[model samples]
Target chain A: AQTVTQSQPEMSVQEAETVTLSCTYDTSESDYYLFWYKQPPSRQMILVIRQEAYKQQNATENRFSVNFQKAAKSFSLKISDSQLGDAAMYFCAYTRAGTASKLTFGTGTRLQVTL
Target chain B: DAMVIQNPRYQVTQFGKPVTLSCSQTLNHNVMYWYQQKSSQAPKLLFHYYDKDFNNEADTPDNFQSRRPNTSFCFLDIRSPGLGDAAMYLCATSRGQGGQETQYFGPGTRLLVL
Candidate 1:
C-alpha cells in the first residue's frame, strides 16, 4: 500500500510571494504518478500540477510547480506569485501506473494567502 | 466544455434514509469514479466504473452502491444513511487508466445526514 504524507497541516503565504507545501510518499513502484489537487471553500477539487516518476524535470503549470524528488520519495508543490485565489486545501496524491489504480492521498495542507 | 457534472450540489437526508447521488460526464470518458471526503480530509475512493465494469475498494462499506447505466451517467446510492456517512461526494472521470491520464473532477455533492 502506498501512503502520501503532508507534514504541514497549514501554510501561510503573503500575496505575490511564494509558498511550498511539502509532501512525501512511500511506494515501491518505480513507475507512478504524483499529483497536487486544490480544493477551494466551494469544495471543488481542481488539479494543480502532476509529476511522473520517470520524468526528471519538474512539472510546471502557470504559477504552480512541483519539486519531485524520486530518490527522497518527496514531491512538493510550489506556488509562485501567489494570489488570494490560491488559498485552499492542497492535497498530494499518488497512483501506480496501471489500469484502475486508485489514488492514495495525503492528509492535506490548508494554504492561506494573506495581504 | 467537456466536464463532469454532479447534481444536487447540496443534499440533506434523515438518518437511515436512502439517498442517491447522480453524476454525468460530457467528456465521454470510459472511467467514472466516486469519492467521499469528510471535513478537512482528503477524498477517498469508494468505487469506480470502467465502462460497465464495477470496481469497489476493499474497505468500502456495503452500504454504498453504484450504478453506471451508460457511458455518460453514473450513480452513487447510499442504502442507509448514517451520521458518519455525511460528507462531500465527488464525481470524477478519466479517459483511461494510466500514469499520463488525468482525472477530471466535478464540484461534488455535500451530503448532510440528520
Candidate 2:
C-alpha cells in the first residue's frame, strides 16, 4: 500500500510571500502520479497541481507549483505570490498508474494566508 | 459547463435510519466515484462506477451500498446511519481510470447522524 505524509499540520504565509508545504510518499511503483488538492472552508476540494513521477521537470500552475523528487520520495507544493484567497487545507495525494486510480492522501496541511 | 453535481447539500438523519445521497453529472463521463471524508481527514474512497460496473473498495463496509441507474446518475445508500457515519460525502467523475485522467469533484454533501 502506498502512503503519503504531510509533516506540517499547518502553515502560515504572508500576503505576496511564498510558502512551501512538505510532502513525502512511500511507493514501490515507478509510474505514479502525485497531486495537491485544496479544500476551502466551504468544503469544496479543488485541484491545485499534479506531477508525474516519470517527469523530471516540476509542474507549475499559475502561482502553484510542485517540487517532485522521485529519488527522495518527496513531493512538495510551493505557493508563490500568495494571496488571502489561498487560505485552505492542502492535501498531498498519490495514485498508481494502470490501476483503480484510487487516491491515497496525506493528513493535510492547513494553509493560512495573513496580511 | 459540464460538471458533477451532488444534491441535498446537507442531510440530517436519525440513528438507525436509512439515507440515500444522489450524484449526477452533465459531463457524461464513464466513471463516477463516492468518497467519505471525516473532519480533518482525507477523503476515503467508498466505491465507484465505470459505466454500469460497480467497484467497491475492500475496506468499505457492507453497510454502505450504491446504485448507478444510467450514465448520468449514481446513488449511495447507507442502510443504517450511525454517529460514526456522519461526515462529508463527495462525488467525483472522470473520463477513464489511471493516474493520467483528471477527476472533477463535486461540492459534497454534509451528513449529520443524530
Candidate 3:
C-alpha cells in the first residue's frame, strides 16, 4: 500500500513571490510515479506536475516545478511567480506502474495568494 | 476538445435512495476510474475499469458499485445513500501507452444527501 502525506494544511504566499508545498510518500515499489494536482474553488482537479522515480531530473512546467528526492521518498511542489489563480487545494499523489494503477492521494494543502 | 464528462454536476438525493452517477469520455481511453472526495479531503479511489475488468479498492465500501458498459462509458452506483455518502464524485480516464499512468479528471458530481 502507498500513502502520501502533505504536512502543511494551509499555506500563504505573496503575489509574484514563490512558495513550496511539502509532500512525502511511502511506497515499497522501486519504480513509481508522483504527482501534484491543484483544485481551485471551482473544485476541479487539475494536473500540475509529475515525476518518475527513475528520473533524477526534476519536472518543470511553466511556473510549476517539483523537487523529487527518491532516497527520502519526498516529492515537493514549487510555484514560481505565484499568482492569485494559484490559490487552491494542492494534492500529492503516488501510483505504482501497472494497468490497474490507482492514485493514492494526500490530505491536501490549501494555498492562499495575497496581493 | 476530447475530455471526460460527468453528468448532473450537482445531485440531490434522499437518504437510502439509490443514485447513479454517469461518466463518459471522448478520449477513448482504455481505463476509467471513480473517486470519492469529501469536503477538504483528498479524493479516494472507489474503483476503476481497465477495459472490462473492474478493480475495487480494498477500503471502498460494499455499498458502492461500478459498471463499465463500454470502453468510453462508466457508472458509479450507490445502492443506499447515507448522509456520510454525500460528497463529490470524480470521474477520470487515461490512455495506457508508454507507461502512461496519468488520469484526466472531469469537473465532478457533487452529491448531496437530504
**Which structure among the candidates has the greatest DockQ?**
2
Error of 2 at A12 (Å): 1.0
Q: Write the residue-wise lDDT of candidate 2 on A1-115 in tens digits.
A: 8899999999999999999999999989999999999988876688889898889999999999998889999999999999999999998999998876788889899999999
Query: In model 1, which residue pairs have backbone atoms overlapping below 3 Å?
Result: none
Q: Taking the candidates in order, what DockQ does each have?
A: 0.69, 0.73, 0.57
lDDT, candidate 3, A1-115, per-residue tens: 7799999999999999999999999989998888998988866688899898899999999999999999999999999999999999999998886536688899999999999
Q: What tens-digit string does per-residue lDDT give for candidate 3 at B9-80?
A: 999999999999999999999888899999978899998888898888888999999999999889999999
Pick the winner on lDDT between candidates 2 and 3.
Answer: 2
Candidate 3 chain A: worst 10 consecutive residues by lDDT? A94-103
Expressed as tens digits, the lDDT of each residue in B63-87 for candidate 2 is 9999999999999999998999999
Give candidate 1 misplaced runs (Cα > 4 Å). none
**TM per candidate:** 0.97, 0.97, 0.95
What is the CAPRI rating of model 2's predicted complex? medium
lDDT for each residue of candidate 1 in B26-92, tens digit (9 for 90 to 100): 9999999999999877789999988899999999999999999999999999999999999999999
Candidates 1 and 3, the one with greater TM-score = 1
Alpha carbon deviation, residue A23, candidate 2 (Å) = 0.9
Candidate 1 is graded, for docking, as medium
Highest TM-score: which candidate? 2
Ranked candidates (DockQ, high to low): 2, 1, 3
Q: Looking at candidate 1, what is the lDDT of residue A80?
A: 98
